[model samples]
Target: MEKFTLESQFQITGIGSASGLVYKENSLFIISDNGSFLYQFDIPYNKLTRIPLVKNAQENIPKKDKYDFESIALKGNKLHIFGSGSTAKREKEITYNLETAATEEKDLSKLYKKIKQTATLSDEDLNIEGAIFFNEKWHLFQRGNGANSKNGIAILNDNFDEKGTIEFILIELPKIKHIETSFTDAILVENKIYFLATAEDTTSTYADGEILGSIIGRIDTQTMKIDFTQKITDINKFEGLTLYNKTQDKMEFFLCEDKDSEVLETTIFKLTLDIKHN
Candidate 1:
């Protein structure tokens, strides 16, 4: 069977709960799920810089007040960050322009509610953890970490100025040791969707649980079917994924982990896989 291998891994100190990742211009931009700042790391994981997401904030945002930014995507010089709509406070979408250093925020409460209705998902089952822009549309991955445990993709129209059409495609992910897997983050290259998912032994999106493991999966977007899935690690809930490099035979990715600890340090892993043709 064709599968990916963990060729290398590294640690990025001084960042915690790395839930979102985007790579551009030889730099990695990261967002912690519970932090008050955005982090930028130079290639080779050498230097680190923190950009305040909240102005004039001297400390990390409180858990209840934090936006719970979970997934991110990059388009040109702009970075789109999404909050995991697990609560009313998390119903936010943020756009950051790198060129002008300006940020815009929008309340996505209505959109999330519409997604729940369209997908037939209960209000408790709408935790969005992965996002990517493909074919001029925004694809949002909803984590199956609630009572209903429904994993799916919510497609939204590119024109965000007005409420455009919405669609949902539900998915069933491979399980780990009887525990269901849920989407954490994903990236798109060519026509394939590569995702990182974790198997947390919990039903509520608000609570953390046993870190069963993490998996790397691929889906053929044309068919809307999973191509392959392989466990990447036995521990460490990796919540962020971004392409590092790609060649004809091999593909490399950078993954970041969220241990759900208070240590204030996160690990960045380098993974390699054999590229196969179907």
Candidate 2:
């Protein structure tokens, strides 16, 4: 399989670190796990703007680095922002009106309780960092640790409720300088499932992890197999990516990377894949 190339990159100003990105036409919506604001970035112009969370929600935002919004996805008229959930018992998701940005928070307390009691999640290493709407359901990825780590795909209904059992898959990735790459985000185009994974350095789960490298993996849903794998060498920690646009031979992807500091690195990428092999 052919890997993707980083066509160009730009240093995003204003916000420090962003954990998730959602694209709508030419506009990119980004959420910072370290801050309580959502940003709207105009890709072509490199323009940036921020929208604050509800005041009460802002006050309740955790001070820890990882205990914040981890991913963003759009479903019909609602834009959902997911929290990394400090622990299984604390998970939460927020839905915003796509047009007005009006928000409503739903604590995933009951859902997490249901999963944990079923032995689906073995340990605290299970963090829902990446998610995508696909096949009339939500595919959520758990960022598993290295050393025989098994990352799982949670199958949820359109309402963000788990249906049956979680799907298990091993991500094939060679450690870049020995850091275990973990799944960060996912993109689904038809029957193909693409995952955005990253390897970073952090002392604990609550700290800000310094990104070491990243990789993108393609999975074939029909055959339940891994089709291709691509490694990203230059980007730091890309916690999120979106399918901007595509044609027959090439596809455009936009990404946001966490700098482990204040500003993030926003990049535009074009990937070419040989369909014959798949």
Highest-TM-score candidate:
1
Best by lDDT: 1
**Candidate 2 residues 45-158, lDDT tens each?**
889887776453341244642347887888888778887654653377877787887988787766555554443554455577777787786777767652334465666566
In terms of lDDT, model 1 sits at: 0.85
Q: Write the per-residue lDDT of candidate 1 for residues 1-278, one digit (tens) a residue.
A: 55667744657787878888887878889998887577888866589988776666323567778888899899878888888998888888888888998888788889898988888888777899999889889899999989999999999987553367888898899999989899999899987999999999999998899999999889999988999888988987989999989999889898888877657777778888888564
Runs in model 2 lying further than 4 Å from the true structure: 1-3, 44-46, 56-62, 65-67, 88-90, 117-123, 146-148, 162-174, 201-203, 208-210, 263-278
The whole-model lDDT of each prediction reads 0.85, 0.67
- What residue pairs are clashing in model 1? none
Error of 1 at 216 (Å): 0.7
| Candidate 1 error regions (>4 Å) | none
Q: Clashing residue pairs, candidate 2?
A: 16-262, 16-263
